[model samples]
Target: MTLLSEFQQTQLPASYANLDPATLTQHIQAAKAQLGSKLLLLAHHYQKDEIVAQADFVGDSLQLAQLAAKNHQADYIVFCGVHFMAETADMLTAADQQVILPDLNAGCSMADMANMYQVTAAWQAIQARYPDEVMPVTYVNSSAAVKAFVGEHGGVIVTSGNAEKVLQWAFTQKQRLFFLPDQHLGRNTAYQLGVPLEQMVLWDPTQGQFKGQADQATRIILWEGWCAVHQQFNVAQIKALRVQDPAIKIIVHPECAYEVVQAADVVGSTHKIMTTVQQSPQATHWAVGTDHNLVQRMQATLPQKIDFINPIACACMTMNRIKLPHLAWCLDQLVAGQVPNQIKVDPETTEKSLSALQRMLMLS
Candidate 1:
């Protein structure tokens, strides 16, 4: 199968760089007003506050994609997230509705860890060993090509919030599970479902095989990939946070290391963490382990009640690439009758990948 060429984002004009944050905000608002209902801005929870302020809808990646699909009235869907997220929105939205990423360079590191070549090679080797015993289960934070590959093999996609249910469904379908990208999420979720550590094996894509011997007892094959931001939160931070505030409830994302998830009082997705923090009593002190921006947002809304486990910012660098200037420029281009940084998956890939995504939606 042929791969799509990389989309390179050109450097913004000097005028955009010269504009202040207030000016950029003005530009974005003006553009949105001009486009009216034709433009739909979707922002992820991890986005900067400025981007979220201008968005028509703000939620997690899957929620935003589903919203894009549901709102067919929009002519343009501006996705303020990573590349994989924009691709997802493009695949889910109507063909007439264009999906645009503010910055083409913004991409998920975890998703990039599993490309077509590496995934196909791993699939071939695993099939040879397990035969009909394995089922492919990819996280939503992956490339469309990878999702299409999973669809072609009768597999389903999983999200952080609904991982356990999806994994449970996968186990019912096959004897063994091949989880893609984030190994930490796979390990953490499988452990919750009563699968012991020894029963799970790690697949080193660099080595093109399992890191160790896989016996019949092996129920999961986790791809050795992780979120750079989530991995930054370690046991030390959890320990320090506990020492600072013994009563503070430690909540973390499953993307964090197994040790961190185990150490925390609660483990959940981004949406879960936000709602937990927001809905909790004002007296409840909370320590969140996820993207720095989301934590910062919570801190602003609920002062003194929230703090990041890692005192040093653990921001998603790729997500941060879509700054106020990029958004302002993207909207400016759209208002000028041009589509900048548009994300479009081919019809063949879209059809195949949508099947896998649909399976996830159905199960969720």
Candidate 2:
């Protein structure tokens, strides 16, 4: 893949840096006129406010995938999120239509934590120790190769919304299960399923070892990884907000650290958080703990009393890499009949990867 050069980044057109709304609107109109209406733009909530403002659809990973599948008329689907999201959209949508990611380097830190090589070695080690009892289950925030590996080992992909239910389902199928790539989500979900905190163990991929373990009956196995943005939310933040304004309701994502989640009044995905705020009639203030973009969007779209649980907002810097200039540049290249930075997963991997994703959609 030929990506942006360092020289290009430093020497972008001076016009782009100072694009006013009028000029931006003109450029966008010209692009649409050239590219036609058969183009769809999907933005994740974690994306910058400028990018989200132009998105045709905005939501979590699953919502974005489903949105792409339903837009059959679109000749191009440009994802404003990370690499995994574009790959997942490609796998779920029509094969001939193009799926382009604005920036190739915009990838999830949590997803990269586990890879095919490390997972294979870990699987072999688990079988050697526990043998038939350990089943492999993975979070959706992982690479396609990891998902296929899970499928081959008879595991499934779980999202934040369905993790607890999936773990309960996994235990019914196997005596024990290994949940990968987001230890906090896995551990918290399993603990909710009545699996003792002592029973849950973490598999450290770097060390190629597991955390201290007790009995064989522990169903949920966790990987030592996390979302850097979600990990920033703290119990202390919640306490300070409580002391300052006890009337405020603290809503957090399930991806937050266990103690922060426990302190939150409502726990859900980014989409769920938005819905909760939109429908609530209590008129109570809100302190949200999630990605910065979604929180900002809430503060902008809602006139109600709501604020961040943490005063200093934390953002995923990588997600901020996909700016409007990048989106316009990528689409402009495609419109000019140059296929640049088009993400194509190998056909063999796509076939198996579909199974893992389909299992989630079916069970969802």
Candidate 3:
């Protein structure tokens, strides 16, 4: 369904617009009770606490998609994450099952950075230069079209947890790798693999050229795109946290800048960050660099012995857009037998994108 018209028709009824926390909770719980196993809620870790508390499964994009793929009994999958995530669930699940996004505007800035047009142009330029020596490796935080592009080019998709493995596999197939949508992730993964800074070049899609020397020796071509949220966690923030409490350990997502990642005591995905904090020693303090919601959630759920703080309080505004009202409204629609903001990828794109996703799952 069209995002604009669908949202217009299914916008939270005026009475539910300013619902109190208790009332909203009741409505959501009632709907869940009514739908039972027919409805499955998938929430990303970055989602607000209220939304996450109601989720049947909470994880990163790939993990959520995997959960949807495995659940054959749920007729409706309500994804309380960004648009691309719902699109991914739609791509991975059976045709009879429907995936709905709580908010159509909940789109990732990093994903938007590398559209099909820009990617196609960049691919053409790179192919002209390196022929078949280059392989495209897109981060999972990208659009379905971008993933399909990678699949069509015999490339694979990678997540933060499996980035190193995927990159290693890519290098085995080609002399050069074009990492997309997030420059920091590409650079960090390549650096860990012994790829020198000099050999890695940054490709500015807007400028349509490489920032550094584009010699034949260039091994990793990084796209000049990054998560607005993770980019806020800089080296200064880490240093400030260290100054305040020298004992506090700093952990961050790999999407942060090279300097930020380098400064972090630990680097991992959102799930990894959560697991680390959960398993840490008692009385240990942590300065996390990721979405604010996740850090806040960890502080609420983890043991009191483990203290958590944000290196920088940065929230992914897009992710935050999926609030309680949006979720309540979406659930009401589902209970009423109406599917609003349903995400459906075209058949061809789903097939090709699934190929890239399956490759990552198999290799990871």
Candidate achieving the largest lDDT = 1
Worst 10 residues of 2 by lDDT: 1-10
* lDDT digits (tens) for residues 1-364 of candidate 3: 2222334334657777788978888889999999999999999999888889999988986688678878899999999988778877888899999988887888889988997878999999999999999999999888888889899889999989889999998899999999999999999999999999999999999988888789999999999999988867778767777888888888889998999888989999888888888888868888788888888778777773333334446689988888888888888889999888888788998898988988888877
* True-structure lDDT of candidate 3: 0.85
- Considering lDDT, which of the candidate structures 1 and 3 is the better prediction for this target? 1
* lDDT (CA) per prediction: 0.89, 0.79, 0.85
Q: Please, what is the TM-score per model?
A: 0.97, 0.92, 0.95
Candidate 2: segments with Cα more than 4 A from true spot: 1-22
**Mind giving the per-residue lDDT tens digits that candidate 2 earns over 1-364?**
2112211222335566577765665665567677776778899989988788777888897688778767788888889998788777777777787787777778889988998778988898888878788878888888877877887778888888777677788889998889889998887888778878878877889998877773575666788999999988899989999999878899998888889989999998777888899888747699999888888888888866888887676788889888777766666666778555666666776787777777777776
Models ranked on lDDT: 1, 3, 2
> Measured by TM-score, how close is model 2 to the native structure?
0.92
RMSD of each: 1.5, 3.0, 2.2
Q: Report, for all candidates in order, the number of backbone clashes.
A: 0, 0, 0
Residue 120 displacement in candidate 3 (angstroms)? 0.9
lDDT of 1 by residue, 1-364 (tens): 3233555566788899899999999999999999999999999999999888888889986688678778889999999998888888889988899989988878889998998999999999999989989999999999999999999899999999889999998999999999999999999999999999999999999989899879889999999999999988899888988888789899999999999999999999988888887788889999899999988898887754887888785699889888899999999999999998788899999999988999888887
